[model samples]
Target: MPAHIGRPVINLGAHRVDTDALIEHIRTTYSDPDEHPRMGVWERIIRNAGVTQRYWTRPLAEATATTGVARRAETAFGDALDLAETAARRALDDAGLDPGDIDGIITSHTTSWTVPNLDVHLVERLGLRPTVARMPLTTLACAGGAHALVRALYFAQARPGARILVVVAETLSTIYHQAETTPQSMIYRALFGDSAGAVIVTGVTDENADGLGPGLLADDPFELVLPGSRDRYWGTIDDDGLHFESTRAAARAAADSLPYLTDWIGNRAVEWVVAHPGGPRIIDDVVAGVGLDPEKHGRHSHASLAENGNLGGAAVLDVLRRMHDDPPVSGDPGVLAAFGPGFNLAAIYGCWA
Candidate 1:
């Protein structure tokens, strides 16, 4: 097989809004301990998401030249772009590569949308090569980080020595609606957090210079199908903001999808499992579905949830960052996975360089 030719993870940069202050504000704002027991439940639920903090653009008031919480929805599109650019630049610096070296750029976000989109603005502001290819993925949910990585890997494989940037920005804070108590809305309130994680991957022949090993994708890999369950999750643009739908069936869907996932990991000694920390219940179902030890990734996943809440598309990247900064018990060959809309699950193989 030909060498895949690029380092999987040369470096990573993560930025977040002030977490402690945000937590305090949330606790203060939702001060009715009696009226909102769920609020208290969430204060505890957030601790398990494997995030310590997140970076966000200004609140809706600041993002928009307006007053009141309802007006904040209007500014979400703009703030997402602001956060993405800031994180992407930091990632380029982390990789010690100039923006001009970037031959491809992939941006992942689920919270907001813009007319020209983030890619166009980033290209101009970062001084990227004029010919740089851009891929913007939206509405993919938590699996987006892994999805972006897969896209970058393919680009590097086709163009040997090419550099690609993957930027994941999400602002769940901007989408929160206090009036709605739908299951989906409650899930968002319980899980979502604001954050961005960026990484630069470059095709490199030398193994030592690469901080991580290249991901060797096996040709003709088996596809594990979840049968595309719409019963799990859905989202749409509404007059006020995008409204999402999540069913109790989602947990059942995750549970039912496990055997197929386990078949994919058959016989592989997964040294580390990097999964998006959706929540304790959702993650537990994922672990059970994949037939893996819940204890293996429990600590990291819990830490992310506890500290960061849920960062939507950025959650898995946050997990990767924690692993990169404080690796899980050192070794080789870690299995990374994430779930997204369309009720999709993506897995990848990575090793320490």
Candidate 2:
């Protein structure tokens, strides 16, 4: 059985943060020359990230303030679970299905460190059956949504008549620690938001798998990790909180994986692309690497960045949601791609159905 993914529902954070306002606040707060000697580079990176606005699950001040690991973890997990529940309920309604219709649950979250992950909490809150299969992915970051969908495809094939619900939620705004002064850290501070997204994958007959509907059915899924590139992005512990860092080489990591991706794409005529809105460069790299028409495709990606910054694990689903809003021609061939901490790449080859 082939699996057809349904349209997703998104729930955004309540606290809106404007890029211009954020820029002003950072300038004033980190004004000491001795502390931030290279403030100019940091400012440029933030400005060039192309994020006009984003939202924080908590107040902007608290999200950026120096806080202990335990406090940050508690707050981030609380907000993430709330948003996830809302998105899951909306997704069930969108698919015209009940909570019992879901035979399996897949959740991807990485914003906080905690035991008894979001999957079990969601299962309890949504009133799902205790026997429903569950898969929890905790560290994929921006690639979480794409990876979950990849897993759902196989789950559908295995169970034949199964229906799987995939959920992704992230409180990335919690990463904004004022203790970090690197240019990369500044770019990250400007490039993330808090959000949750959920969608359903239903097992369908072969005839219904390759045609036009509201979404792309899963036909093929691919992943790649570049050699010796593990350090492109990583995390560390500090007195303030968990800190995510990106190397200067990280800017080129997405494009660097293109050769392997293109080899997989082969002769497939790609009519569209759903790129993760990690930043301006990531989107541009997709457009360039895949030979997509810059004037037309990947608009959803750029739009997501401008409207909501980066929603971490929820970023790709938001991109897919925009694709659903203004749909493509029936049966259009496209690829979904995202990058994460391991310098890992995940892509799905599918067509509009």
- The lDDT leader among the candidates is 2
| Local accuracy of candidate 2 as per-residue lDDT tens digits, 1-353 | 55788888889999999987887778888888786567677778888998999988877777788778889989999999999999999999887789998999999999898889999999999999999999999999989999999999989888876889999999998888887777778888989999999999876776544442578777888998888999899877676777798788998999899999999999998889999999888998887789996547878999999999999878999999999988889888989999998899998888887
Candidate 2 versus truth, CA RMSD in Å, comes to: 1.8
The local lDDT score (0 to 100) that residue 277 gets in candidate 1 is: 83
- Error in Å for residue 25 of model 2: 1.5
Please, what are the lDDT tens digits per residue for candidate 1 over residues 1-353?
11132222212123344445544655665568564666655555444444456444565224223234345544665566666777777776656778887889988777765556667777888889889999988767677877877776667667766677888777676555555544456456546666676777665445534453433322112223378687687776665666567787776655666676667778766566666687777666665555567776555666777667767777777767666666645345556667776787766665544
lDDT of 1 at 68: 47
Clashes of 1: 22
Worst 10 residues of 2 by lDDT: 205-214
